[model samples]
Target chain A: MSKHTSMALRRPSRLSPDRLRVVVPILALLAMLVATGFLQPRVMSYFGFTLLLRYSLPLLFATMAQLCILVVGDIDLGIGPFVSLVNCIVASWLADQPWLCGIALVGAIFAYAAMGAFIQYRRLPSIVVTLGFSFIWLGAALLVRPTPGGTVPDWLIAATGFRTPLVPMPALLAIVVAFIAHHLIMRTAYGTVLRGIGSNAAAVERAGWSLLVGRALLYGAAGFCGVLAGLTLSGLNTTGDPWVGAQYTLLSIAGAIIGGAEFSGGIVSPIGAVFGAMIMLLSSSLLSFLNISTDWQLSLQGGLLTLVLALRTLSVWVGK
Target chain B: MKQIKFASASALALLMALGCHAAKADDASALKDTSKSGIALSNSYAGNTWRQQMLRVWQAAAQQAIDGHIIAKTKIVNADASAPQQASQIENLILEGWNSIVLDAASPTALNGSIEDACKQGITVVVFDSLATAPCAYKVAYDYVEAGRIPARFIVQQLHGKGNVLVVRGMPGTQVDVDEFQGAQEVFKENPGIKVVGTVNGQWTESVANKEVAGILPSLPKVDAVIGQGGDSVGTYQAFKAAGRPIPLITLGTRQEELALWEKLDKATPGGYATEASSSVPGVSSIAFWVAQQIVAGRKVPNVVKVSLLQISKADLATWLKVTPVGAVASPVYSKEWTIDLLKSIAANTAPPPSPGPTQNK
Candidate 1:
């Protein structure tokens, strides 16, 4: 074959770049699904889109929240406890008052935001402070809803979980959030400041933007998202179980890393984190259907995360 | 400089303003000095209403004047379930001069230091449901290991010494988990026929048990029964519903809950395990109150209290007497006053431990 002919044939396909990017992961997931189906088709149906969404939304919101912190290249261990703290608050106080839910919920979100701001101002390790904060808030939450029996109001749950006629509202909201995130992150000065600080806070320090302010804003935003997810789950169950928020801490971190977010400042995206959460949720539910052991579910999650990281690394290298 | 002056002047202004507030606080503290003493309650919610019930039970216990001993006041601090939070709360409460503590601690190990600290400060400590690493001034709650053994023995006999039985357990790394699973395992070791086919942590929630059971269904063989550790029994039932499968189910906690399952399984009556929900919390609360009494009176309390667990089937639901006394709005409300009164009684009694009662199956 002539070199020119070979080069012409190798030219990029007609598929849009964004479409191509989306299709690759979807196809990979399909292949995995088909393989699992051959092993047990029942497992496949149990973990379909809506079911996966049901499991993923909380973690998705959590990781999306974490993305704010990660974008600025800072870590906030407190989001985990923050999620639980807010959950306890909602579970105990507004649990019965469905009518006053909107006002109460909005007020709570502001309080959580203030907490995040305080942490940033203190310039303490988020892991330590958040961990401590978790105890305080959890203690406060339990002081109210000591037992685990209650149901979320119906409307909020519907708004969050419904997916008919092709668009899963949760995913759609995630996408909108992702786009808004992408714009704010890539287009705005705060986004640039975050990248700068994340990459080299020392350099950014000389660049004039306050690392403290960036961290506060990002973490506060992350916390707001965390509370949103907690509130959403509270709506799903209507009763707040205090321990519910604690589980998401590890799960959210796993989602963020698994979704292909890098350790460094420039590598995270809200969209990627959500996709990662969806995949992890789907995979776990599928495993549950397959009757895999809890130990294996964790090992598999770790394994999948490694595979995603490897693939991301390969993609970057090959593209370069 | 301006910020410091503004802050100090505001502080001075606030100090003068708060001087008036201090008068009220001093008067309030003075009034309580002789009549009412402060007590702190710490616990793990474990989804078992026992700890939650303590809040109410102690208040009731406090109401009883023991030999003209004015049972001044009580404060309830709960962790819901977190070990770390309870430890911190203990520290803060101690700093605030709470000299007596009743703990249904989150974990046995987590409470050791706090208990020791309380003891050092001349604070009387009472622990139950789970114990501190060290013995308390007094301890009262069901002997968890024995509780497991009673249920295990019956379930093993019903399983006919051999079958695949799933054990749905409570929180991991907890005293309840340690003691109950330990006792149950000892019994299982003796009976080779009883195999622990699967074990899952339901965190004592029905929904979790339901999901875990559903997750394991395809891999699980046809099983004889499930022995859920705590509240997750309901979820295990739900799992059976989700999986479209059924087997005889034996779970514990409340009588009504058990009967509820039997009712669902038999398709005969409304689910009412009259014994479990009605009796379990209040019974534990009764024991805690007794333990608290030992501390307040400067007397030794037994290391453990054991309540005979009742297995309520559909057959028994009809005449099931709710053990937790009746109160307004679920009248058998486990009140706090019972705990304080019970604590004083146990503390006052230094005699040999009384022989336990017959297994009352109501």
Candidate 2:
């Protein structure tokens, strides 16, 4: 609690990176809100919030999965397929045999954790290993369901599809997720060791923290988040496509980066990551609403991301 | 000198007649040797239910041909949506000595070189569905532009060409979407009163269409009609139902869900709501198979045969739905005889290509 209070009191001079991480994403999100209000006034309604944030659950989960790895100074290239595999499993088996699906999900998490251990033990490049694992996950998903047709369990759908009277379900979910992840990654002592290991592994090692165990936990947490994300997505659509989450791999990385998590630095804020994911998703909808051509829309999105990232870099340099 | 010239002219005419008879005999022999004819399918992608149904139709047709001794064997190689891979697959099929290669190309131009190479090797290349643009290949694709026009025109007629319309488009920048959109736009242009209120990209999938339509439903004014490409009506219907809005006249696709909804609506709503469903049925691949058989039998086939979209009216919805299983695709049932007749008519240049026009719902 003292640590949380101190974090809130930290000035820009003391914690510039933490503050700058969320600045651009917040600004971009605000700009989109303004644009939406002007371009389409009805999106300001409660229904509009539900519509805008309906498909964002999967994205938010993917961001959390990626955030876990970024905190440990590694990346999960297989996050897309990992989420896709979970969706496939949930769509086909979970609704029928919840116990079996639960066991399989646990197995998948173990696999991810084992992958982390293998990488740490063998000193292999995580990028190559995870890239290889992505295919394995995709192949598994395809083998389970060739084409995208399966019914999500009624309970899962009901939970995801439920809307509060005024507050959209996604905002409520995001708050819950941010709060939980914040405590797990920021408030906990293990989190401090995780961040400490990321910045200076030797210092953490000298302090008697096992790097292998830490990596395994982080990867395990990532797997759990991925499953949650996949289930939420499947719940949202009440169907599964093996290839639906392919875009999420890059989006997750970009969201984490945009949220203030650097590649090598142990700079990740849970709330910032959520906002970053929202901003990334909002831009896609914003472009469509603006009546941009499909060919130019992707380029425009890339340009917008580049602009925000450049802003973040400039601010950091100036603050220093 | 006049008598000599006349005699020579008669003799030359006699020789020409004999040459024609010899060519006829050659074609007869080729037809008799149908057991030696082999047709191979080069598929670009088999990822969706439509492609699955297409493969089934092709297999059933190929099996029939094999049983009738029209073709010796059939081989199929799916490239999993890769253009270069499909091209190479076609190349390999040519090398394997197929009499004709029926292809569903990934792109109009990417497979041109491979298709031309096959044609050069004395193979009849029949491109269908997503067709290749090579002159050397015979294209047997449905006019997707016409497919789009049928729905737009239906909506215009139903709404009396004056109403707010919402366009639920397919994946952005896709050829199918572009052609369909252009056709709809052409109809809308002709009728100035039919105002397009808003357009949303449905991504050619039900869930996407549902989500996008649901998202924009609040922002849109009271839509009198909806113009959609195939695979979207179910989503559009679902969106309107969720919003508790009076369902407008929607263009249905091939999905069983869409057909089921159409059936339900036909019974529930008075005067059947003036709705119609249209699409290029996946079983049209059987038409491609029949065309391949004709080319292999030494029939002089045309460079292109355009198939029209199947528009199932509200009254005829049950007939289509009867054959379409629950959760399955609504594909046309093309019998072997029907395919052969279609192929023969097209080969003989008797069946004129369908001109793009306003499709009559009746």
Candidate 3:
């Protein structure tokens, strides 16, 4: 515990690349929030923040899931479809048979872990395997709920609907989840092992750590986050759709990247990923508040994303 | 020539007088001053030709209403065909304090929560094309079941109830697909002579339909007729032609490509190629716009308003082909008068007014 505290507290220095990486996303997020607030002052209020942040919950979880995979030098092209499948199960089975839902969710986690083992053992490219699995996940989701109608359990709805008088429920949940993820991934010894494997697999193996176990554990964790995302999405939407979360795979990758996670692996910021997710989700709201024409909204959103990434690159250069 | 000119002048005068009288009647019944009311459109996706046409139609209609002092302002927000994105857009629309929202939803049930929130805020919500199941929101929708039944009926009659048929379906797991397939099955089940030898998911696109049909065509026996959801008829035709089989009687959609194909095929054959063309018009967005405006103006509108599908018979095919531009869906723009008449007919349980054909562009 002392060692973990020291490592967590060691990042107090100014002008560090790691610190700058996290700060850039936060600054981008704040900039977007200010721009939006300037345009629509109503959105500056408590109710306004609640409305703006409500839909970001699922995305935040998904981005964390992607961050887990990215931390281990693997990319999950299947996260979106996996989340969609979980959404189908949550909406269809959770209300009717909670036991079945539990079993199915656990079974999915194992499936993800097994996929990790298979890919590692066979020395297969993760991108190819995950891409193949995406189709399988989409097909399974369709089989579970062919159409876009399913009843989310009342308890689940109430759970997602939980509101606080002070901070909005979604914002509070986002911060809590971010801290938990940050603690687990940054302060835990096992997280170091995961990161070690990503940076130097042979060194980790030479250190008597099992690379297979680390990869499987991280993949399982990702699966768990994906399931959470799907459940929260179902609760919020109050229904299920097999195709609803299809856009999330790319969004999560972008969020993870924007949040200072690297494709080269061994680097991720849980809190930054949450902020990154918020930035991505709220930019559209900002555009909407600005009353941009519908034809130009999408292009402007892309431009904003590019701008944020450029800022991130500039921050890294400054830190250097 | 002088006599003809004088007669036309009197007819034009009578028409103008009648038009003025209709305007006077409409003005007297206007309850609320909607001149200060604002309406917004929350569209789910603007990716496809159909949705693009729908947005264009809405923009034109909304601008006209604004210029005519029917509404104070209008705005549009489009999402990326995702339920969560659209739900967020709807929430933002509510916060923006729009008096009315017209929606082309991404999903029927996924948007209910946001729709309910909008309704609770006292916003007039009108969902069209792809509708929401929320009780508070009004729906302006197509009779997709009837849309299915008509073409299937046409195919059954043409085949004399005895033929091997192929069913080219729309996107799987969609309500529209289910309804249309159900309606087609109802007719086919009633007639025992028609055998549905094969079925493929066309996904309501020409390229996908072509590939799916081509993949399934080799194993099946001779296909006498093909029944398709709109947008796939041309593809089904192309698939059959590529396979070196004689083109059978394939039902057509209202796509310009389909109509153009119909014209080409009709002229090529000794006897005219006969097939029916029918699909929901993208201009239904204008109807939804008008519905929202009328509701905001304090007019009583039904919770569910049905718009008729645009149907093209053999004789009208030439007219549709003439006016329909390449790569555009054949649709007649809906006017405010037409929408009011539609609402009145729905309330009175009578047939809605007939949709006019597209005016020939010089």
Candidate 4:
């Protein structure tokens, strides 16, 4: 810790870009919250925040899953369908057959790990491989629940609906998950080694870390987060749909990128990713609150995303 | 002057009695003041042509309601067909304190939790078109079975109950698709002479229907008639045209493109090319709007309200074609008065009034 502090102190300029990335998403989130509060002051209350952040829990978890893959220097195009697949399992089997649901979820993780190992071995592009897997996941989900009807387990609903007096459950869950993910991915020694693999796989391999195992573990972690996201979504919705999470693929990627995770890998902020997801979620609410025309809503959302990216770029240049 | 005054007084009494009789029949006395009520529409998607038309119809209805002081204000929020996003939007609408929320949902069951929450808060909730299955919320929906039955019966009649028919189905696994398919299948099964030789999932899109039909065209026997569940008739016609096959009696949706093609074929052919067009009208949003308004006004409403499918026959085809814009569906904007009568009929367990076709040109 002292060494890191001293190094950072010695070369503050080198770390400023990373610092700016974290700070910018936070600033954007705050700006959105403030704007929303201005438009609908009632949303400033505890209940209001609860409502605003309720559906974001799934997105936050999905973004973390994307972050796990992004940190491994591979994008998972199948995460959206994989999440939907997990949701179908949770909604269908978890209620009547807990053992079957458990087995299926574990099998999904193994499937993801196998895909990762295969990609590493064959030198195949992760994008193409995962895109292919996306169809498989979608087909499996459709087979499990052909339509959008399933009973979410009562225990799961009770867990997701768990509330507190001072803080909203969804907000609390996001913060807690962010902290744990941050500690696992940033604070530990293996975390450094994992990031090293992303930055220099050959060097890490030379240092005696099995690249296949590392990639598989990261993919497994991503699958785990996706399962959590799916389960939470099912609980919140009280139902399952094969196509419900189809939009999460791009949304998660955008959230991870806006949170300071680079496509080239070796950098990520768990806290920032959560805030980035929150910002994206809140912007839509803000637009709705401001009564923007429905025709302009989608394009305006795209414009906001571009504006944030540009701001991040500007900040990076300024930091330099 | 005395005799005239007495006569006028008796006439006023008679009119009052008639007014009471009508009010009792329609339960208009149950309506409470809703001048200060705010209503909102939480639409699941606005990407497709049908959804776009629905939104326009909703906005027109909402604006008139606001102008006439039926509602104080109205708002609309559209999500990108994501259930969670729509659920969140509903929560936001709840926060905005809308007295009533009319929604075209993304999923039937996915929005139940949020919808129930709204209902718990004493907010009147109306789910229409793509409806939610929340017990607490009212549902406005088309008789999809009837929609399917109409087209199948038309095809059966056209073919004299002896032909190989092709079925272009809508999005697989959807309730609408299932109901329509069941209705069509029931009709086809009863008539042993009509064999459904081929069936393809159209996903309710023109291009997909065309592609699927073209792919299956070579393998299937000659198709004498084609039955489609809306949005696929033009594509089916195109595929048949491309395959150099005789254009059979293809049942159409209310799309202007389909109507135009029908017109073209009618003019070109020796005998007039004839078929029927029917689908759930986009203007059902206006019906949903009034339902929400009436509910907010403390009117008793059924949990499920069945709307009539908009059907255009050969006689009404030219009239609908003339009024419907290119790329838009034929729909009649449902008025508040009509909705009230519909509720009365539903309550009375009588035949609901027929939909008045296309109020004005779009």
Residue by residue across A1-320, what tens digits does model 1's lDDT show? Answer: 69877875678444533233344455655665675566544333422333334545567788888777667555656566566656656656564674465565566566556655676677665567667766766776666556543445566556654655666566677677767877887688778878777678788889787776777677667767877787766554444555656656666776776654667765565555666666765665455445453346567878877776776666656654
The whole-model lDDT of each prediction reads: 0.60, 0.79, 0.88, 0.87
TM-score of chain B of 4: 0.91
Q: How close is candidate 2 to the true structure, as a TM-score?
A: 0.51
Order of candidate numbers by DockQ, starting with the best: 4, 3, 1, 2
How do the residues B5-94 of candidate 4 rate in per-residue lDDT, one tens digit apiece? 999999999999999888885565536779899999999988888888998899999899889887899888888888888898899898
Task: Please estimate how well model 3 matches the true structure, expressed as its whole-model Cα lDDT.
Answer: 0.88
| DockQ, cand. 2 | 0.01
TM-score of chain A of each: 0.78, 0.93, 0.92, 0.94
Off by over 4 Å in 3: A1-13, A119-125, A200-202, A293-302, B1-28, B152-168, B184-226, B236-249, B269-271, B360-362
Candidate 3 residue-wise lDDT, A178-206, digit = tens: 89998999899988888887778899999
In candidate 1 the C-alpha lDDT for residue A13 amounts to 43
How would you encode candidate 3's per-residue C-alpha lDDT over B135-251 as one tens digit per residue?
A: 999999898999899999998999999999999999986789999999999999999999999999999899999999999999989898999998998889999999999899999
Off by over 4 Å in 1: A1-30, A33-48, A95-122, A161-163, A310-320, B1-362
Candidate order by lDDT, decreasing, is 3, 4, 2, 1
Error of 4 at A25 (Å): 3.1
- For model 2, residues B209-308, the per-residue Cα lDDT tens digits are 9999999999999999988887888888899999999998888886788888877887899766567778887777888988778777766766887777
lDDT of 4: 0.87
Better of 2 and 3 by DockQ: 3
Q: What is the alpha-carbon lDDT of model 2 when measured against the actual structure?
A: 0.79
Q: Per-candidate DockQ versus the true complex?
A: 0.03, 0.01, 0.54, 0.60
